[model samples]
Target: MVNFKGIGEIIKILNMNYSKKNYAIDVSGRGKATPPPLQHLLDPINKIVHSQRCATVTLPCILKAPLPKNYKVRWSKVEPAEYMEVVILITNGAHHKTYGPLGSRVRLRHSHRYDASLTISNVALEDEGRYRCQLINGLEDESLTLVLELDGVVFPYQTNYGRYKFNYFEAKQACQRQDSRLATYGQLYKAWTEGLDWCNAGWVMEGTVHYPIINSREPCGGRLLLPGVRSYGAKNKSKDRFDAFCFSSAVKGRVYFIRGHLNFKEAIQACQKDRATIAKVGQLYAAWKFSKLDHCDGGWLEDGSVRYPIITPRTGCGGLPDPGVRSFGFPSKLRKKYGVYCFSVK
Candidate 1:
């Protein structure tokens, strides 16, 4: 009986030792079950994060985050409903302005990551606040803030359209103010094709007529063309009737002008006396520019030709000699005659 009892005791001790060993193994398993080290788990998904807001009073918040090859960064505002007015989407980088409606959300694809930066354009005044960039990996997320302020003015290219009228002198002044001069022929051609005329006459620097003088050998001879005049002449045939000389910047080859109230022959003599001649259409076109044409009651052309006319020396008169009417147009033959004018440029 004693031997049997001792054997039973030994068996009981072995069972207890086995149970303790099992418990230790189970505990070790539970303790070791701790997730892989955070760094090792994050290695494949780790990313650098950054964000920014424009310094301008009206601009959108800009957010940036480093992402894996296929990972994407999502953006959202953490503000309340009333504060939602501050969110905007950027479109164009050149202008650096926000353009979309406020509170509008946009999704950026993973393909757009360049140096881990994403830009929003045309931010508004209310968009001048905090912003968050939410980096999404698996189910985890991280965010950053960008502050913005409004500071600079947005300038666009000139695009105003309307009919503007001004005299030659006034036009020049206007061009100077606008940091541009009268439109050149090429500009006029473009404007015309683009249908910008709107029935307004454009100004060509070539429209001003400077009276010239005849050479000394000519019948109506004068030394120093136009008599000691260093520049072309501005002659007023009558009160309030002033004629000036204009040139075309586009065509540096020649000059042109409109003649007012004169016969063809007298116009020729007048131009000869000044060492200038009547303007031709080609010359007119070469020197033409775009400008607002004014509608005036009445104006005269040399030789009474509403259309431009040619000027040449007076040669033959059928029967009359020394007639005061020395021009070759119907008006010149009439009892009432007007003087001829021409233009010239250096």
Candidate 2:
């Protein structure tokens, strides 16, 4: 029979052999020399390194790993199965594989066993969603999920700017919502003269209009008018033609009408309240096309010191002289009381 010390020596040798072999062995207390305790030996070995033995994968875009390498990474829309290609670059040398809705393109770089990297570019809104990486080694495999988000670009006029017609105030609100403003005079002029009006009508910036502050004058006002022209008329015959204003820029020119319907006295008061003055002949001419004046009523001409009516040979009514034929202040009764519309440039 084996002695106590002899049996102990045999067990120690068996234990040492098991350690070097990287295997589990069991021993029994009986003289029969039973197989080493398989389960007991394996418990500690499994606990120490089972998880670490498997290959680990990482995505620069992902926080965890065991992702696949050297495989086609497919990217698709979350809601729809449409395939998309996203550009991805791997930073680490570890072999990895990408799969399922990976976007447009996949680029891989070799990395260390534990190190990895990934990147995507030219991302689109639909490209946003979940992405996954799968990794495989001879004996073990792992996988991880990553989320991709793509930002969208929004252009102006996509909102109500195209659908509705907004006055100055309403237009301003619309622009603000779209992160833009109404077109400016410069913009409007550019659009019109440069033929960009074919593009759209509301180019002016918010709170901007050809007719803000009611009565205002244009700079280089008189220069825009046609030579030998004294007056202008409206398009509608039955309706009294209001004074028209013209604005010219290096890019283009536009004509706008002052809101009409006020008598001469009322017009003067309106201009005063708005800090403006009555429209002048040259300004009116600049806005009115003589070819288009068939229905418009001519405007009043004022040279600062005097006012004259454009109506030729003003018919005498109840002994009142014709104001049209006479020079400044000829029609005494029509002097200051003459009804007229005005504009301001400020």
TM-score of each candidate? Answer: 0.21, 0.20
lDDT tens digits, residue span 1-85, model 2: 1122444454443333334334332232112322333211111211111111012222342223444344232222122111222
Model 2: ten consecutive residues of lowest lDDT = 45-54
Residues 1-346 of candidate 1: C-alpha lDDT, one tens digit per residue: 0122343343332223333223221111113212222210122231322221222122122234333334434343323212222323322222222324543423332243232233443343334334444343543333333443322111001112223334455544444332234443333433334322122233433332122222232332334334211222332223212222222222223443333455455556666777876543223323323211111112123324322222221344323321111213233233224443344654
Error of 1 at 299 (Å): 40
**Runs off by more than 4 Å, candidate 1:** 1-66, 80-100, 103-116, 152-346
Q: Residue 317, candidate 2: how far off, in angstroms?
A: 50
Candidate 1: how large is its RMSD?
32.5
How does each model score on lDDT?
A: 0.31, 0.31
